[model samples]
Target: MTGTDERPDAFARTDDGVSVAYQCRGDEAGRPLVLLAGQANNHHWWDGVREDFHGTARTITLDYRGTGASDAPRDGYSTPRFADDVVGVLDALGIERADVYGTSMGGRVAQWVAARHPERVRRLVLGCTSPGGPLAVERDASVRRALAQPDPDAVRQTLTELMYSPGWIAEHPVPYGTLGDPGMPPHARRGHLVASNRHDAWNALPSVVAPTLILHGDQDRLTPPENVPLLAARIPDARAHLLPGARHAYFEEHREAAGALVREFLG
Candidate 1:
């Protein structure tokens, strides 16, 4: 509803009764495409990339539980539960299959979806994400400390550095200033982080039958690009793409190029 598309703002109730908010854009009859955001972020973060798929596919973006307009449950915030929320949305919309694109923590959830519900996923795009658990390449202590900053401006500055290349940040000041701020309360944010920390997709990767595209920024500090190849090698039919000079927000920092790659792969 927030995009150029005319679809109404909608909500789908998950099996546990949490209400998940989502929006649909592009051609409904076209291939269904689901966009999942990273940790502490919501569906609105996909605004910058959704336009690229406008006429080619039906783009669906949803708020994970405890973020955006979705109802935050007191518990059950694990990656598996998050994956079920996605499938719940698909079932509510009467979609039999979809191509899923996830970033950061959302990618972990997407892995669960593809592994646990293989019949429902046609393809997967894991951007700036990791396989999770002990196999995941974690950020340095300073980066982790930056994430824990309480000041909004400090948090933004730290995130900009962690997410975008210097050139991209300088060129896109406005977008950088208005980055998607997940309005979850402190407790909810903590819960989300806990869920992220618990994600373990290593065992599930080999079972994901859907063809996968693992895209990462060459300069990503949060999830090192080295994890890309390791992740690709684990999946049966996975491809890895390293965007030169881009950071964790590679898809956003290199919007046109990254979007083109996604379009080509999804086509």
Candidate 2:
């Protein structure tokens, strides 16, 4: 059986009147490690590393606007608005600077955090994320087809193809029944995906000054492994980790290995 959706330990109200949903784990006195989740994912991505890093850092995971426990804005989402929401979360929590850990679309925000408000970021860790929209949003036919399909079953099956590694599927195949029950609501998931697809940052990647760690699965189908070399070469102080046999969900596909790598990189 699948698990119930988890709740954050505490929530801070944002200036937009939306409640920025978040969970804090580890020592309250530790350095801040804020998790910015990717599109179609909430704080759930941190399930493996949350507790492990909590002792070393005050780990926090946030549900961006229109995703997870965060309020869905009526007008909808874009990179700028999403960036504002991140600022709002930090403001409410009284955090001045933080080590940002972002995945997929969350990584995009981390990029903006360094670009627009460089002072807010202490360091950044981006996983399976692209630099911007042009190459970022170009969808593969099959994945796009699945998103447009009316049947939820079809979409879930399609996403699984891009999300896990062949080795993972071979040994720990996901149960088809529970796979596509997305964490975010249906309408919101589509909006989040829309925001992710349309985001373009190629013109601005060079401006990022904060130290960055970029990790991608060599076998990634969605973002593709090529992006690893491409992103690392451009962003100054950026390092890339191309993990073999890993896929889109690098953390979940190789949780233990990823955990050790992250601890060292973040420390």
On lDDT, the candidate that comes out on top is 1
* Steric clash pairs (candidate 1): none
Off by over 4 Å in 1: 1-3, 175-182
In candidate 1, what are the lDDT values of residues 147-263, reduced to their tens digit? Answer: 788898897788778887777768776554224554787777878889989989898899999999989989889888878987898899999899988888888878888999998
Evaluated against the true structure, the overall lDDT of model 2 is 0.72
Distance from true location, Cα of 143 in model 2, Å:
3.4
| lDDT by residue for model 2 (73-149), tens | 66557765677777777777799998888877788877777777778888888888887755553446765677679
Instruction: Please give each candidate's TM-score.
Output: 0.94, 0.87
List candidate 2 segments past 4 Å from native.
1-9, 135-139, 170-186
Per-candidate count of clashing residue pairs (backbone under 3 Å): 0, 4
Candidate that would win on TM-score = 1
Candidate 1: C-alpha lDDT? 0.85
CA lDDT scores, all candidates in order: 0.85, 0.72
